[model samples]
Target: MREEGKSIDEAINIAGETRFLPVVLTSITAICGLIPIAMNPNPQIAPLAIVLIGGLISSTILSRIVTPVMYKLIPPQMDEKI
Candidate 1:
């Protein structure tokens, strides 16, 4: 994107759109995993499910808020071009 002369913000927006489907799929998978654990209580297996669900939920929310801002704040280093 930098090579194409796109700004970081534009790149971030485009990248997010491109990556949206994979995110949705994973979110659904996480929720599906959560359901089985919720239905039958297993002390050991449940914690991992809870942690994954919590992380997935919070990170999805936070990243949607943070990623673009972070991209804007930290401009790409010229030496970091792929």
Candidate 2:
């Protein structure tokens, strides 16, 4: 987006909008896939699956919110060629 001459804010908004659906759908799919594992009676695998699901939920939410804020707070370092 930066390479396409979009301003940083515009680029971020566009990227975020485009990515929201895929990110959410992927997470939802993974969560659905893991539900059976999490529900299994096997103690070892069930705990692991539950933890993984939790991590995925947290990461998906955080990335959607924090990444854009961080990008805005920290300006990119662009190199200009003469």
Candidate 3:
């Protein structure tokens, strides 16, 4: 979006909106895929699966909320010409 000359806020908004579906779908798919492993009676695999599920959930939530807010708060770096 910025490459197309959109302002920072517009770019951020557009990017966030554009990425929302894919991110959510991927996360949901991964979580669902991991469900059987997470429920496994194999202790080692089950714990790993549980951790991965939690990580996926936390990262998905944080990226959706924190990323946009941080982008808004931080100023974009400008290229310095000699």
The candidate that wins on TM-score is 2
Local distance difference test values of all predictions, in order:
0.79, 0.94, 0.91
For candidate 2, the 10 contiguous residues with the lowest summed lDDT are: 73-82
* Candidate 2 residue lDDT tens string, 1-82: 8877889999899989999999999999999999999999998899999999999999999989999999989968777768
lDDT of 3: 0.91
Kindly provide the TM-score of model 1 when superposed on the true structure, using C-alpha atoms. 0.75
Quantify how close model 3 is to the true structure by its C-alpha RMSD in Å: 2.0
RMSD of 1: 2.9
Query: Which stretches of model 1 miss by more than 4 angstroms?
Result: 80-82
Q: Write the per-residue lDDT of candidate 3 for residues 37-69, one digit (tens) a residue.
A: 999999889999999999999999999999998
Rank ordering of all candidates by lDDT, starting from the highest: 2, 3, 1
lDDT of 1 by residue, 1-82 (tens): 8768887778888988887778878887888878778556778887887788888888877777787788788877866546
> Candidate 3 — which residues are off by over 4 angstroms?
80-82
Q: List the residue pairs that clash in candidate 3.
A: none
- Top lDDT: which candidate number? 2
The regions of model 2 sitting more than 4 angstroms off are none
